[model samples]
Target: MTYRVFSRATVLGTAALLMLGHLPQAHADNAEDLITRGRYIADASDCSACHTVKGGRPFAGGMAFKLPTGSIYSSNITPDPAHGIGGWSEAEFSRAVREGTRQNGASLYPAMPFPSYARMSDSDIHALYAYFMKGVQPVAEAPPASDIPWPLSMRWPMSLWRAAFAPSVPSAQKDVTRPFPDPAIARGAYLVEGPGHCGACHSPRGVALQEKALSGSGGPLFLSGGAPIDGFVPTSLRQDQRTGLASWSEDDIVAFLSTGRNRKGEAFGGMTDAISHGTQHLSQEDLHAMARYLLSLDPGHPTATAWHYDPAAAAALQRGDTTAQGAKLYVDHCAACHRTDGRGYAPAFPPLAGNPVVMSDKPDSLVHVVQSGAALPGMAKAPSAFVMPAYGRMLSTQQIADVVTFIRGAWGNNASPVDAATVAGLEKSAPRPVLQDKPAPLN
Candidate 1:
């Protein structure tokens, strides 16, 4: 099979270049200034999403990544100087940030999303390095090791992967950058494409987990939404009325991205994670820009065909003998607020009739949701919803699968049926829910 380069491939190689001997000579710039800039860059770039462990020290790496090759764990990026990147030269830090290479010779797993960071300007990388070394508090927690099996974990292969796919350039405007009515929107585009790397999740991945487009290249819909992430279908940010954000205003966009809450509804599923760890820390300008750029998309639906669920199968959900088993489960468990119609409270429960999470082919998401009951903010807010309790403790794997499948396929919905076995697996895979610092508004 032919393999192609992903946005990240280029990112890793380019980040590598940043490390090529450009050590931070004792510059006259004040340490505080460097730390401040680094903190901004880190926040803007969402470094913690990959580098930090949940419930652990800030910036201490231990996030587990499921790579095509094998599972990889993020290393601690702290300034411990021994276990972390502390003793590395400035160029080394830059390369790791911009490229995928580490201090001496180890190759970083592509899960690091360096391809996107590779485009970041050198100054930004320098600032980030300085912050880690001099500004921010480093934790003593050692990073958890990866679990890539046998030959696949053989680090040397990653070099070939880098050579075949990684880019060596930095983020700069091309000969042509698109016009934006709002400068904030323009800035958002830059952040999304360069540091934010939203496309890594919002955009579709090709054969080898490469982001289909970098900077959402083909159209405004680039990172707009309606793509499968993990197993859930993320809503598009574009201005399309139904599947896209057409109904949302600029302010709504800003609010949603920043606080994970808005008039349209609270952020849900994976989005909750993104906001809690990534977007929440972004500057008001960057958040506004991201919202602006996303809203500006021309109603591009990445998975139009995929988003369309199987109608015939869904019809069976409405009429089959099994329907009763599912319906009772839903009502007894779900109906109080979502309503029997499956049209959840607007912007709150998210009408299941068309909720992307319910319509996804990969039932892992729907199943996970039913069994685990969405961790704290994973249910979106501003409405402060989630009356649903943890079914993991209450319901059997089979019961969870039946109800979730019913939710996904009933009403006007049309999604693949979720098997009980799938639900069982999800029960084993997902992480335990945690309390958010502050809960989002429930509708």
Candidate 2:
């Protein structure tokens, strides 16, 4: 038989037809891929942080959110037909995730972070649904009902809030796309804005109490930071040299995520939970991607005076001076772990000199740590776990303020001085758990 010659267009057309003929199989393969991706997305989102109770089955729910008005327990999300979302269709799940509406037409509190989830792509949502439905084990346990009081408990107002604050999701058929200069940056943006929901804590809030910026580009406030969570202020993720991550390299961010501690300091408070559950499990590539994206953000605001080593404070500290209450306090209480030089034992007590945590403008994280103390989240990669002893009972408000001021100002940290009134207000807002006579052993 004589071979028939074909034009390039004709050959391409035939190849397209062949691909279309295998569309069903391709679609099935895509579904599997989506399920796999969904698992990663779920981990990145730290769904377990809110949905799963401590020592409980994953995604079975029961975690209680202690809000301003009252406590709200997370709903069971396992694929149990009776107690979970097993019966939910993809549409229903998407609505709940993106619109903050329950299958029963009830409004979900902003605590769910659906406003950020609204930015999620349809493919990602589909993937998440597939993962939840097919991959997760089913549990029949029902979540406890919310304990929010009268008017606040009502769901109707949330609809109004949703309408006012929530970003609109494109139709499922329409693809939502964000253009980034690099593919890695785009991936990082997705993780931060969609699933990670970093802005829910890092971004400032508007008058209506909604997050001021949903995504990094929404404004300077996006990750410029000033938001408060559980009495701790989430520090700025911006590139500001003094208050933000300007000094951190991409590796520093990756190290912190992987081990919950970097050269700068260890994560505490809400960040501990995020690292222990969410980011620690992420692939090195993903962590790097997130770091790359974060590094690209503009600095929130440049400080008038850059931080430099304080010779005067060093001299005073060296002189055995008990004149400044702060210096005396540091010597008596902090010197053992933090050391007289402020260079704490790495991978343990974290350094104070040039540390971002110490230099942050808000001082909330520092105050919270001093007042409540914190148990470092256990991570597989970390060498050991430690607990900071709570000083709320031992230290007077002025003493706490004084010590905080000393650290912030003494070690090349140029943040504003903290006052006793500020310390007292935080103490009242969020009281620490009672400390036992004997300290718990660091594992």
Candidate 3:
């Protein structure tokens, strides 16, 4: 055997060459991992909800959002150079996403929810950019221009709106830090206030259309409740027993987020789209984190007591005594699906007895559901698309109001009674609920 001694310089050079040889493969693997992470981030951010039209290509845009100004269509976000962000530099993408400015320096309307997205970390933004640029299929489609009228449609005003209302990204990041001792809560806060942008629909807005509060520390207004969106009021996510998630356990919240239903209620309206495209795809760990953070909130109405189920209405109905004006309507129409006990089949027909939605301060959602009817959107965990059929065409406004009043008042529910006037008002405003492949915007 012949042994050859290698000099130190030769050994070092050979080792360097071996490492350099693997760099391309290593870089490729890293890029793939980043793209995968970006996909998850996009799902969490619910990028598809507003961007994709029903039965249309994902992120191809053309979803119409009816605003007070006029109807504005979502822009195509695919990688097509002509119509999408394919030509955008990472800095341009970051500016648009965080500061609500387009690549051309035109301001994006608040409907895009960039204020909430401003809280996203740099890493998450980077990953999202990588995924949109590398993983998403290019689509050569252009959406219609906004009919928002000239002065309102002018992008300059949006710059003023951002200056007056939008929080700085750094300040928003600081607000999500260590409010609670648990790191999980911190993570949850980041997800909710950042990528999730739950407040865009769930939190009340100011006269300027800015959300009243951005994070938990901002006040109880954050996720407390929101104005009617597409005829359904976004109920409070706070711990209010009557109208929020006070009674929901962490697991119950997780179940609702992942499966789109729990013992409490089923997802309807914009919530359906939110779950099918967003929360259902989240990891269990993240789901639990969100649940824990949500549950940590104090009751919006601190003096409110937990809702209890009363058998009085059920017993009265069983005895065939429909003394109340609305009682007869409830028995005739609602009793079949929502049983006499007011508890519908689990995960199918959601229980009305002591349901938060039924007892919400504003009965908009319940009234709208009764009038236009709602469909419980399907997902991987709950594949059944259960629908509450529209009664608007069949029932008079008064009759619809009466039945809604009955549902809200019966079974120990103490919400304010609905009136024919309220129902009449909604008749002119509320959109008929439709169960499409992709749900319309929640707000």
- lDDT by residue (1-443, candidate 3, tens digit) is 99999999999999999999999999999999999999999999999999988889889999999997799999999999999999999999998999999999999998999999999999999999999999999999999988988887788988999998899888887876745869888888889889999999999998998999988988899999999999888988999887899888999999999978998789888998898889999999999999988988887679888888899999999999999769998888888888999998877778999888899888888888888877665678777667677788789999998888888889899778889999999878777655444433332
The model with the greatest TM-score is: 3
lDDT of each: 0.66, 0.83, 0.88
Report the lDDT tens digits of candidate 1 across residue range 265-307: 5565667767766777776777777777776677674445433
Q: What's the residue-level lDDT of 301 in candidate 2?
A: 83
What is the Å distance of residue 353 in model 1 from its true position? 4.6
Over 4 Å off, model 3 = 435-443
Which regions in candidate 1 have their CA more than 4 angstroms from the true location? Answer: 1-31, 67-70, 171-182, 218-246, 268-270, 301-325, 341-353, 377-388, 396-398, 409-411, 414-443
RMSD of each: 13.8, 5.7, 2.6
Q: Which ten residues in a row have the lowest lDDT in candidate 3?
A: 434-443
Among the numbered candidates, top lDDT falls to 3
Each prediction's TM-score versus the true structure: 0.75, 0.87, 0.96
TM-score of 3: 0.96
**Comparing 1 and 3 by lDDT, which wins?**
3
Looking at model 2, the pairs that clash are none
lDDT of 2 by residue, 1-443 (tens): 99999999999999999999999999989878888898888888888889878779989998888877889899899999999999999999999998999999899888898988887877788889999998899999998888888887999999999988988786311222556879998888878777888888888898888988787767678887757788788888988776778888999999999888988788888888898779988999999999998998888786534556666666777788757648899888888998777878977789887777788767888888888887775577775677788888799899999999888877677667999999988887664643644433322
